[model samples]
Target: MIHLQFRKVHGNEGESEAPKRSAAARKSIGLKAKAERFASRNGSRSPGKSPKGRVPKRTARLESDRTSVASAIAGTRSTAPPRPRSKHFANAVRAYEAAIKLMHAEDFGRAIRSFEDLIAEHSEEPEIQERAKVLIHACEKKLHENER
Candidate 1:
């Protein structure tokens, strides 16, 4: 002989399903744990705090180093001499004046040649070189128009 009996169980007769977490939530949780471990290893009281709540003695040394650096800079500044005026300035000015005079006299060929020589000789004077180049272009244009 066999007997059958029914017993009451939880209303939902299924495996308990945990609430699902998104990928971003999982990554955030992992990052939080890693940060906590890193802080503890470094003797920090909290994630955003300095270790042991004490200022390191290096602050004093840093102050001394800063003063030494400042003095060294000042010493170098005192020892260095001021720059002298360029020796080529007078010559460059003279050549530039001559080129301008030739241009005004309508001697385009000579003016262009003088400007070109100035550019070749005093490349260090960029302002003069640029002016000479523009004048040379103007002289060439005039010469071309005269030809036509």
Candidate 2:
């Protein structure tokens, strides 16, 4: 069923609701409409929308040694959604990041200690442990240069 309402126009004729508004009002309406359309389209294609027999990129990435510091630094990464991480793994990452931050801040002594702690605490994380070993050497060299 359809209902039609007829309004008598006093001055302007054949004008749409879109055109009747001021320029800013029209612009706002256009943007809002565009955003709504985009959201609807994006929702249909979102990662979890079809998650059957699929390993999310995050977990699958960690399954290989390819998930290393070098790849992260190069920004050679995927755009897929991340799988949830274990508490232990999350803690390990936090510790590693903290050490890296200290290294970036040029606090080599503390960074060395922190990286060593990460290696000790997260030995199950071979990728992290290997990277930490390499970074420890870099920190050692930096300390040596400073002492000279």
Candidate 3:
């Protein structure tokens, strides 16, 4: 009978199929360690200020102040809903009229698209909805006529 024995090495004892670290991993680790050491020595000074003197105000605070100043300059809070139209239905009427004109002109493609836009934007307007349906039918008739 023959007896075989194995002795465990210190670094390779438990590493059966562990992958080796790539060069990129080693570089990243070195950079992170250097950054940590630099931060520790600097002790919370603003990024470009001298470490021997008092730290300056943070650039992040300046950014927030600028944003508030910009909002003041714009003269209104951003919470307002967007304007529906210059006169709150005038623009929709204009678009609806344009669609009707296109339908009358036998420009079925643009007419259909315009009517679809009006219906999407102002579906609650009964007049516009009715007009859109009529214009759609007219556009279909014009398209069929053109195909013939």
Candidate 4:
């Protein structure tokens, strides 16, 4: 049974019943609840293990790599790897150096294009991708400054 409360308006001329929600209208909410349920049901995290308050493996690896790169550039050589890196890695290094050369040459427009291309082509190298993104932003800033 639904109880409707009536309120009298000015001059006692109008009476309005309170709004009531139907049964079917109660469950519809935002997409966040649905997404949480879907992610939990999927393998986003192990069923037995809690993902809260934990850094993901991929993020940890990227952080370590960034630190190693900073150390290497700061004149402290990184430790030797277990094996030689692949040719693709070597090619990416060369390409990144070329883009840096363009930046040094003050060719911000071309450097931005080069960095964008590197990002698109070298999806496997997150470090390079991140560096390229930073460079692209820098280049865009310089280009905008020069235009002003």
Residue 147, model 2, lDDT: 95
lDDT of 3: 0.77
What TM-score against the true fold does each predicted structure earn? Answer: 0.43, 0.43, 0.40, 0.44
Give one digit per residue, the lDDT tens place, for model 1 in 1-148. 0111111343433324444579999799889889889877986766456556575568889999999999989877755565565879779989999999999999999999999999999988888999899999999999999999
Poorest stretch of ten by lDDT in candidate 4 = 1-10
Give candidate 3 misplaced runs (Cα > 4 Å): 1-86
For every candidate, C-alpha RMSD to the true structure in Å: 11.8, 17.3, 13.5, 18.7
**lDDT, ranked from best to worst:** 1, 2, 4, 3
Residue 142 miss distance in model 4 (angstroms): 0.4
Q: What is the C-alpha lDDT of each candidate?
A: 0.83, 0.81, 0.77, 0.78
Per residue, candidate 3 scores C-alpha lDDT tens digits across 1-148 of: 0111222334555455555579999799888778878878987544665655467768999999999999897886556786465453787889888987887787899999999988888866777788788878878887998899
Candidate 3 residue pairs in clash (backbone atoms < 3 Å)? none
Runs in model 1 with CA error above 4 Å? 1-84
Q: Least lDDT summed over 10 consecutive residues: which range in candidate 3?
A: 1-10
Q: Which lDDT tens digits does candidate 2 get at residues 48-116?
A: 467666855676666555657676866876677875768998899999999999999999999999999
Which prediction has more favorable TM-score, 1 or 4? 4
- For each candidate, how many residue pairs have backbone atoms clashing (under 3 Å)? 0, 0, 0, 0
* Candidate 1 lDDT score relative to the true structure: 0.83
Q: Pull out the clashing pairs in model 4.
A: none
